[model samples]
Target: MKQSLYIYNNGDLKRKDNTLQFTTYEGDKRDIPIERISDIYILSEMSFNTAFINYISQYGIPLHFFNYYNFYTGSYYPKESLLAGQLLVKQVEHYTCYDERLVIAKEFIKAAADNIYRNLRYYNSRGKDVAECMKEVNSLRKKLDHTEFIEELMGIEGNIRKNYYKAWNTIVNQEIQFEKRVMHPPDNMINSLISFVNSLIYAKTLSEIYHTQLDPTISYLHEQGFRRYSLCLDVSEVFKPLIGDRLIFSLLNKNQITEKSFTKELNFLHLKKEASRLIVTEFEKRMKQTIMHKELGKKVSYQYLIRLEAYKLIKHLIGEKEYEGFRIWW
Candidate 1:
């Protein structure tokens, strides 16, 4: 598998004939093979010419950018190489038709809620005393199928997440004052961590979606809007509980990430470069972790699972198979 390239230092990235090269401000140079990179993550200031962009674009490598505060800025998505006009139409049709759209949207929430509940159960089994939160989440999940409108469904999802976040206080061993989920400049360490890690998951999903024929902007759960890939938001909702949240839980419980990991002077809004690198490294390892896939009768990495979700969506759009969101069976 091709690995993701992360740049956490000030540098200049240039296309060196067939390969890639990065030179730091101090004049240190390193060569990178273009074929070995799946995607690029820029966490610091970097400069590259059009020739570099053209080379990466030719190979369909996306570049995800983050601001100085470590918040996601945007991505440089390459042109679609695998375009299926019929599939695009079908994708739009599903979004335009309320009933069809609701079916896919509900599945996303159901899978997410189920995974959230599973996380609580995993912790409760380890004596984390999250049983009350588990009950609350389960009750709210049942109401998902009964929601008549999209608004009602979203309201239920919000409640389910609210209760899920409540359990974190007990699940984590650290003395974190995590009461609720907050974005738009997360107020606390937990909130800041959530925003940063979830952004990485969204970027990874976008990269996986690029390899497929699906249009990233067209989505079911989240409304399609300008300058956004809403389909990634929809697909990532199902995996965040399994991939992102679990990683957060592990990092905290094991004391791998602590309050000291963030910049206290920045109101805990800024994650230091070392902390960010550690999170990305652990996340990459988790993505490469494999589990036995029942349907395929073989093992598959967690990263491939995201691509499988996209393939499943394509099958649903083409009427080859019904869409069923991924739920943890392991």
Candidate 2:
């Protein structure tokens, strides 16, 4: 399993003949072998030339960039080396056909809703008073099968999220008055953390999709839009509860992250550099953690689960199998 390389220091990245090197402004250097990296995340200001881009492209490693506010900018996706023309056609066909699209879209919502309920249940079991939220989410989840249009499905998902977010106050040990979900400069620490961590999940999903034959732009749950990988958004909905949300809960409950993690002067919108690094460190560890996979009859890392979701989508597209979005069985 190659690791994701995260650059947090202001430096110059250069291609060192089959390897990569980062030189800080303070006159320090560190070398990284190309083979050890699956992808690169640039979280600080960095300068590089076309040669550096060309080198990573040859190895099929993507680069995810973030701005000064710790918000996701975009990704440097290499040209797809595993392109399947027939599969691409099927992907678009599913998106164009409303009935087919609804089937997959509903599955995505169903799995995501199930995972959300599981989170509330887990916390409720731990003595958190989220039982009422759990009831609301469970009630909304039952309506997934009846949703005939994408718009209707999205409405239910929104309501489920609304109820889920309400439970966060009781779930976390910290007394951060988290009300509703907010974006475009998240209003509080919890919202800022959600935006930052969810972006990481989206980037991670994009990297997983790049390895498969599926086109990331053609999606069922989210409308296809220019300059965006909507397929990642669709797939990320299934795993965010299990991966991103749980991680946030743990970080706050254990005091690993708190209000001090953000710059108060920036309206708590800017995550301090050290805090950002700590979040990424814990996130990487979470990705590498493995669980027993009953279907595979062995253990698989959490990161590989995203890749498996892509493979499952491919199977559904190629008529090898019927698509069923991943629901946590454990």
lDDT of 2 at 319: 86
lDDT of 2 by residue, 1-330 (tens): 589999999999999977999999897999999999999999999999999999999999999999999999999999999989999999999888899899999999999999999999988999999999999999999998998899999999999999999999999989988889999879999999999999999999999999999889999999887338999999999999999999999999999899899999989999999999999999999999999998999999999999999999899888899888888787
Candidate lDDT scores, in order, read: 0.94, 0.93
Candidate 1 lDDT tens digits, 65-99: 99988899999999999979999999989998999
Weakest lDDT window of 10 consecutive positions for candidate 2 = 219-228
Assess the local accuracy of residue 140 in candidate 2 as a C-alpha lDDT between 0 and 100: 96
> What's the C-alpha lDDT at position 129 in model 2?
96
Q: What is the lDDT of candidate 1?
A: 0.94
Once model 1 is optimally superposed onto the true structure by TM-score, how far is the C-alpha of residue 156 displaced, in angstroms? 0.7
| Per-prediction TM-score to the true structure, in the order listed | 0.99, 0.98
**How many pairs of residues collide in model 1?**
0
| Cα misplacement distance, residue 127 of candidate 1 (Å) | 0.6
Which portions of model 1 miss their true places by more than 4 Å? none
